[model samples]
Target chain A: MTADRGRNRRTAALLISGGVLLALFLVSLTLGRYPVPLWDVVRILWHRFWALFGLSTPVVWTDAMEIAVISVRLPRVVMACLVGCSLSAAGATFQGVFRNPMASPDILGASSGAAFGAALAILLGCSARFVTIFAFLGAILTVALVFLISARAPGLRVVNLILAGIMVGSLFSAGTSYLKLVADPANQLPAITYWLLGSLSGTRLASILPAAIPMALGLVPLLLLRWRLNLLSLGDSEARALGVNTDLLRAVLILCATLVTAASISVSGVIGWVGLVIPHLSRKLVGSDNRALLPCSMLTGAAFLLLVDDVSRNLLATEIPIGILTAVIGAPFFIYLLLRKEKTL
Target chain B: MKKTIALLLAAMMLIALVGCTKTPNAPDAAGTRSFTDSVGRTVEVPNEITKVAISGPLAQIVVFALCPDRLVGIAQKWDKTAERFLATEYYQLPELGQLYGGKGEMNLETLLSSGAQVVIDVGEPKGSIREDLDALSEQTGIPFVHITATIGTMGEAYQKLGELLNMPEEAEALATYCDAQYARITEIAERVDKANLLYITGDKGLNVIARDSYHAEIIDLLGNNLAVVDSPSSKGTGNEVDMESLLLWDPDVILFAPDSVYASVGSDPLWSELKAIRNGTYYEVPMGPYNWMGFPPSVQRILGMLWMAKLLYPDAADYDLYAEAAAYFRLFYHCELSEADYDALVRNSVGKQ
Candidate 1:
């Protein structure tokens, strides 16, 4: 009876958070340096939405308002949500699979590898498209290299994979440092450093749309197998005894997790704490049944990051890097959560 | 098999050592001459320096202005835009990279092969810089000289560099020009009411040159920099501000960096709300060979001063901007700016009449 009550409460919490996220997204569209009235913002969005399907509505607002709402702000808000959702989801999965509370999406060296690729591309004077492509490739390749090394050396223990990931992550981080060292200090070095810090300032619909495909492809499989993730969280021998093909399940999870992580970092640069903190925050609200935890973390992360990004761009005359604000806000909130209640996974 | 492999490696190591030690054949260094550098370090340089390498871009600009012929290796590769202003001979100089501003892949082998007698660095020194430079000098067997050059002290720095390079006539002329420009600006600064200005950079128009930053020296001297924060940061980019703060500040004029939001800012609805933008007092800083505004905060800022003075108060500081720009280009860049070139450079840059 109590278990039923808990499930009911979790469902309620999810619905509330989801509603909050949607409300925040709508509010964000109205807020910017250019003040578009609430009604005007709604009208502009409604007109654009209908216009997409070969329909025309009366154009009430100016082209500038339409551009600001549709072009400038929409992509940034969407990218923030997608990145937040992917990072949090990946973080939860990695922690569940590894049976370690501390594992983030970048446990497999994805963030570091992506950073190296982006830095190298910038150093070579490549365009933004090439930088994103290189970042994605760097992340996927680093994880692949990690899996290859761990498989070759010895038993496929989770610890072995984690250790290999650390080694590979360090190597790519060093490569990024070298690129920063060689870049033109006036233009390229600052570009690389700012990129590493992560901002959504230059986001466009063109960049956001391409990255969404990979994120969805990675996310769907995880959502489907979320129930089975509970079984995998058990020790390997125990999971196998319980009729779970631990090896196959682990491989699939790692692949999906890596894809989402690489794609997220590729678009947003290295936004750190959402993946690490959001899962913990979700777990505190809803107990760790991968079924409930995964979706809850996703919604929470999306809202959390959207709010942080809004503050980051709006709080000052200069847009603070989203990564810096995430750590600053997340780290303190995480500590408060820790002090409020001590729970072991 | 292992023994054979070890032997091969040893032989390769020996060859590499020999290759590195074979110094380029140049006129034998005249008996060493000792001179005190700006940082109070007395270092022995070759008495007759026929060739030289710069440690970074700041040094490259200063050295290039005085003696382009003597520069054996450039700190950076010249792009096509830079090449347009520079002489054809300077276009092909070997790129040795740099050791400062986080761009630290100074190719020692290339510097050595270029046959440069000494490496010259011109900038503010920081955090055991003397020791660091000394160590680098010892490692490369090339004497490194550090010369301090702030906006205020650039004239003196030029004079000192001239004495070191034995190009008193060229250095004196450049130094005199710098001093005269500085004096001219300071004189006019006293007479005119300073305009409230904010210098912004970055693609999103968030980065601000805060009051009293090293990069804001010219802005401070010429105008009232309104982006005042309690503690200013000197990182890769300038300090960041939000639209709310910018709206509150409402600067009378806004100067955009060359690679910043200057292109798209006019179309930006929020940016267009700014008094500077609405009044069309916003201007993109000009760049040909280098940014006229001191991005690196070098001697090039003298031109920025003249340009800003005219841009701010056209009536009070009445000088033929084109004539001054042409003279500056000829003197510092060693390129003649034709009327067409000047028009192209200043196109869409002047405030809307």
Candidate 2:
């Protein structure tokens, strides 16, 4: 009876979180630098939704309004959802796999690699699209390098992998710093700085699908394998004793998480706190159980980032970098949640 | 505990009160004369002024134009493109870094060893100008003074710069020349109807110099700059907006930064949706040594205004662009403008890049 109640409560929590995410998504789509009325935001989304199904309604809204909501705002809203969901889910997966409370999505040098790649691209005066491509390549390469080094090391596999990650990540960070030093101060330096401090201000409908497809690829497997993440957390010896290939499972999970992280960061740049903080916040709300935690983290992160991006685009005429807002806003909220948890204790 | 606390509080108040009354301005020494600067800070400057240091690139440009020989060091190293336009001695000065924003701070060791008598800061006054200059002056033991140099008032800046540098006749000639050019630009600006224009920058051509920004002084003066955002970015990259916003803005004339998507914007299908792109009204800003439009906002923009004027309204400009370019190159850059160099500089600017 107690187990059934626990399951029911978890289901209830998921439904509520999903509802909140949906509501935030709509809110985010409405809010932007361009003033589109609330009603028009609905009308544009509604008209575009039916148009996708070949039901062309009578056009009442202006092209600018349609373009603002559908072309400009929709992609940004979607990018936020993709980045937030990927980071949170990946972060949770890393924590569970490593059995480390401090592990984040960039635990394997993905973010630093992305940063170095982005800085180099900016230094080369590459277009925004190429910058994203270079960043994605950088992330994948660094993580692969980490795996290669860790594979041959003579320590505990997870420990060696983490140490290798630290070394590689630091080297990439140093590379990013060097690029910044050498970049043209007039234009390239600011572009690189803005890229380092993540933003969704550059998101376009055309760029969205490329990033989203890879993010979906990584996220779908993460959801399917979340039940097994719990087994890995119970120690590799115990999981192996129970007849699971712990090494293979760990490798697949890490790759999936890395892919999602790289794709999200390449598009949105390096948004920090969502990956590191959201899963912990989700764990507080749900539990440490990966089955409940992963979905919860994804939903909460999507909502959190969507909310932050809304404020980022709408709060000022200039874009306050999304990464900055995440920490500035998230730290206080996290502290509040922790305090509430402490009070309950 | 209350007695000890009261004693500590009393001591702290005493320190604060003493600090408030302590005048940072030192009384005039024998060799220095008091000069009232733009921000109304009376600074004791050397009477026989020779070596001058600049605070940043903006100051470097104006100072170089006025007294190129006196500058102790360049704030930023001139690019290789400047080699043909500027003498090696001027462009190859030891870089003193900068006092304010950019990659590096002012190298004190370099400045001290270079034997600069006074450091002069010119450009728009940031909020903490007086305090910052005074603090630098105190720290370096070299008098620091600020002279306000705006896009509209650099002519007057030349006169003030002349006073500080003790070169009134040369300052007068340059000042009069600047005043004439600015007045002509303003007259030409008033003669034409403002076109809906967008100045786009960044490698992607997604950023816009918003209306009322310092960078958009010429754009706003000449045309209706449409990229009005809530908080305009002060950085040279401007505000980063997507292509959709560009389409929504739908400017009649689009000016691309020299470093931006001028070379490839024509090929993109998404960009081709914009009326400016479709109409082929987009053009790159001219650059040789520096962007004619204000990035660091130096005296070179005197030519930028004329180019923009002629580009926007040919009839009202009422002056030969090549004639103006040749004269500006001779006076400011100290390089002769061959017809070919002028053509090359403005080749893409006149039409599509």
TM-score of each predicted structure versus truth = 0.54, 0.54
Model 1 over residues B1-353: C-alpha lDDT tens digits? 99996777667556545543443443355467887889888888877777998977778887788888899878777645677777788877777767632124453434554667788998876434575566556545677888888777778888988878777888899888888889989888888899999988888889887898757778888999998987664533577778999999999899988888887878889988899888888998877677788766677888889888988888878899999999988987788988888877776567555
Interface RMSD for each predicted structure: 25.2, 24.4
Error of 2 at A240 (Å): 0.9
lDDT of 1: 0.81
Give, for candidate 2 chain B, the lowest lDDT window spanning 10 residues.
B100-109
Which regions of candidate 1 are displaced past 4 Å?
Answer: A342-345, B1-353
Candidate 2's docking class is incorrect
Candidate 1 structure, TM-score to reference: 0.54
Model 2 TM-score, 2 decimals: 0.54
lDDT of 2 by residue, B244-291 (tens): 788889999999999999889789888889898889988899997889
Model 1, span A11-100: residue lDDT tens: 998998899999999988877655568998998888778668644455556444556677667877898899999999999999999999
Error of 1 at A145 (Å): 0.6
Model 2, span A1-345: residue lDDT tens: 977877787788889999999998988877765556898788777767876865444455544455567756787789899899999999999999999988999999999999999888777656566788999999999999999999999979999999999999999999998787656555457668878888886466778899989988999999999999999999999999999999999999999999999999998888987887899887776778899999999999999899998887666434567989998987887688767734220
Best by lDDT: 2
Model 2 deviation from native, Cα RMSD in Å:
23.0
